[model samples]
Target: MTSFQDKAILAEHAIRGVLPPTPLQRNVHLSEAFGADIWLKREDLSPVRSYKLRGAFNAMRKVLAGDPGKADFVCASAGNHAQGVAYMCKYFQVKGTIFMPVTTPQQKIDKTRIFGGEHIEISLVGDYFDDTLRAAQAYCADIDGHFLSPFDDEDVIEGQATVAVEIEAQLGGMPDRIILPVGGGGLSAGVRSYVGDRCALTFVEPIGGACLLAALQAGGPVDLRKVDTFADGAAVGRIGVRTFDRLRDVSLVDMIQVSEDRLCITMLEMLNIEGVVLEPAGALAIDALKDLREQIAGKQVVCVASGGNFDFERLPEVKERAQRFAGLKKYFVLRMPQRPGALKEFLGILGPEDDISRFEYLKKSARNFGSVLIGLETKRAENFDALLSKLEAAGFTYTDITDDEILAQFLI
Candidate 1:
């Protein structure tokens, strides 16, 4: 039997013929901020802009090598994994059928097409991922095509373990700690297996789609009632059974769940401050550093920046979420008296640094008072406190809807 390290080394050898090893660079800005030596394994720089292709390529190569006549592959993925499979299928000159949800963004669909070129076919089947997955499985069974699971298969896990192999090679040795983003547990499990307690490991997950955390808590894989799809790459509802078996021994204390809103803050920071474009899932490991400041201070730490498949069209939403998380922006419903001086009086209460980004009167028909939807932006978060205090002293009745998800969904 091949040892885990040998498998990883062999996988790396297989991958070297395709793409160069992704860069492992020390991030000076992050190092300065956290008072630690910070390095980022830039899997975002892969050919398909994610570490996913590593697994996809390795798995396909192994299968084709075993049965040279096998030529078809099938997979279900909404984003990165689909692109990975598509790219590999084209590289291997094999036919691939990719199943994706109807709701997948056009950007992803177009990228997948570009990666696969004429060698792959894409089917937009269901409104949700589960439906798409079932359709893919059924089609694979019908055609006798090899079904490539995104994270559940042994070969896929071995392929992903190549990431650890590259990290070790690039860094000369394992760092003090390695932070990983967990979705279905493929990458985390692979890296954990390869490292094998040589370095500390921390797993980060989006709070809304924490399948790994849930599985760890329940002592097995279990479906989450609901999952937030904001971090599409890591938004898995259930941990894979194979992956869970590998990760079942992981201590719950080592897992950290970051809020979706907080992830936005990290994404925006990486873009605006560091000039790095990271998708929501890509930001998980870096965002986790905020929670590990003390533990990693003055230590060498590596955070895997998983993928950079961000859609520029989502910039407005990303900025809005970041602003809301930082408390630099807020929305409110205010009841204003319908008097001549009412508008002026409310305007007068605004702080010098506060700017009105949105204003609309909901009920102009009400003679006594008007219901106003107001969005305020400020240079500093504390300015909102002063603005709110002034509004209260002025006897204006208002409801802060910035933190109200239900109201924000409908009204904001």
Candidate 2:
């Protein structure tokens, strides 16, 4: 039997050949905020800024030990896993062929190149990961190269189990509760396999792309009809079949789906208040606390901050989402008189704290009135109530299009 203890020992040995242990620090801010002893496993601080290297390192080491002639490796990934494989290829003195979606950020591609140096060759394939994966698999088969799956392989799971082993040692024992973010289910399955009833685990998934929840509901892996890529790291369309098999019996109650916008709020809070930088997936465990407030009260809880490969270009969208979730900002369509003082009169109803972030007047269908799109932002959410009341009293006919998905998508 491939027990967790065996994998833990192997991971210890394998990881030492690559990098030092990531930090496991108690988060005072989180503890105070949630009324629990909150600890963070900072896997984001790894050399590649992710826990993927552990799995790649362990798998390559074991494979080489068994057959040294199997030197070349292949895999497809759009982000962290690609970097992990590239770095491992350099460390193991093996050739690697990495396939990535063409739409992947330039920074990620450059970082992968830096890690792999001359040992890895990267090919940009189709715009989506599914297409890229198909290309990589076919290429690997044609060349008779060892195809390294990011999570499905038994070795990868055993390697990922190392995170659980380290958590146990670093915390001095199993924590009362463990919270993890799930994408393809690899990390969650592996860690849960190792922990094995020793700790209570809560799995968090992005609401828009909850592959694990779907798989659990279906009693097997099922592809999502659509995936929202806002939480890119955790926006997997389908959980890996093997990983899902390992996680099949997980209780539905233990799974929590967090809205992408809510995650943005948590990310901003962690950055602004706690001075922590976390990608969307990295913030999952911390954000999940809201749902588990009752269960984890006064208990020791550990949250895995999975990865920190955030791109600053997305910060504006993150801020916008956070503001919307907090109710401090809203977008709406307004009907206004086309007369000269109509616009000025509408603006007069605004509270001092309410700022017009967006204002656009569309063509007037009627001679006396026009349709206007307005975005309002305020320092406090309550400011909206006062602003709305003033508008109502002023007799300005308006419709709040903020919650209208089709309209918001087109205008907001």
Candidate 3:
């Protein structure tokens, strides 16, 4: 039997001419902040702007080589995977049927169309990914087409292992530590297998979509009740069975789960400070460094920035969430007296750094005990403490609704 390393080398050779090495550049901003020699494995710089193309290309080539008559391929994805398969279909001049959820953003749909060119057909399927996946599988079975799993297949894992192959070649060797973001476990499992025990590995996952953690606790793969898809690239409801088999022994200490709101701060920081635009999933490895500061300080570290396919239209929501996580922005319901000077009196208690970003009537505008919705932004997170104290001293009654998920979903 061929060894994993031998197979990875085969994949490396298969993709050598297709994907030139994605840059493994040392990131100055990240290095300074973390007090480490931080090198970024910029998979985001790939031709498709993500590492998914690597797996898609390798898997398709292998399938065609094994069975020449297999011309039809099908896949389901809301983001990078769909774009990847579509890209390879055009490359191989093969027919591909991609199924995307109805809720997929128009920008992603258009991009997938552009990549596949004349070789691929896209079907807008169900509203959710699971529904979309089932539909794609059934359609592929009906048409006698090959179904390309997004991550689970052995060939796909080998394809993703090519990332590790490049890291070794480009960086001269593995760094002291390599941080990888886990979704369905393809990239993390592949890299972990390739690197072996030579380097320390840290896995990052969005807290809301921590399938790997759940599997570890259960001692096997299991579906999550729900997944928060903000980090859509990493929002898998379950880990791939074949992939997780390679990753089952990873310690819980080796995994870091980050909140979605907290991840937005890192995305914004990388964009604003480093001029590097990263999607939420792409920022996971870098965000994990916050917890590993003492362990990784002064050590050579590599963080995989997995994808950069971020929509600029979501910027405002990202900024708002980031601010809320940092405690620099807050929302509250204020109960004001009916008197004319009541609003003026409430404004007087605010510190100089506190600025009202939103103020509106939640009830009748001039009615006694009118309810008002107020949003405040401050220069620092601590400024809210001083402002709230003033509200207490003045006998003003208000409810801090900054972290109220239910109310936020409806009103904010």
TM-scores of the models, in the given order? 0.98, 0.97, 0.98
- Tens digits of per-residue lDDT for model 1 on 1-412? 8897899889999899899999999999999999999999999999998999988998999999999888999999989999999999989999999999999888899999999999999999999899999999999999999999999988899999998999999989999999999999899999998999899999999999999989988988999999999998899999999888889999977889998988999998899898999999999999999999999999999999999999999999998998999999999999999988999999999878999999988886476888999999999998987888889999999999999989999889
Residue 47 lDDT in model 1?
A: 91
Q: Please give, for residues 47-130, the per-residue lDDT of candidate 3 as tens digits.
A: 888999988988899899999889999999989999999999998999999999999899999999999999999899998888
Model 2 C-alpha lDDT versus the unseen true structure: 0.90
Q: Pairs clashing in candidate 1?
A: none
lDDT at 152 for candidate 1? 96
Compute the lDDT for candidate 1. 0.93
Candidate 2, residue 192: lDDT: 87
lDDT tens digits by residue: candidate 2, 1-412: 8667786767776687678778999999989988999999998999988888888888888889999999889999988899999999999889999999999999999999999999999999998899999999999999988888888877788787788888898888999999999988878988888888988999999998899999988888998999999888889999998898889999999999999999999999988998888899999999999999899999999999999989889999999998998999998778888789987898788888889999998668588888888899999999988888888888887788767879888888
Q: Judged by TM-score relative to the true structure, which candidate is superior, 2 or 3?
A: 3
**Index of the highest-lDDT prediction:** 1
Model 3, residue 233: C-alpha shift (Å): 0.4
TM-score of 3: 0.98
Residue runs of model 3 more than 4 Å from their true location after superposition: 364-367
lDDT of each: 0.93, 0.90, 0.92
Arranged by lDDT with the best first, the candidates are 1, 3, 2
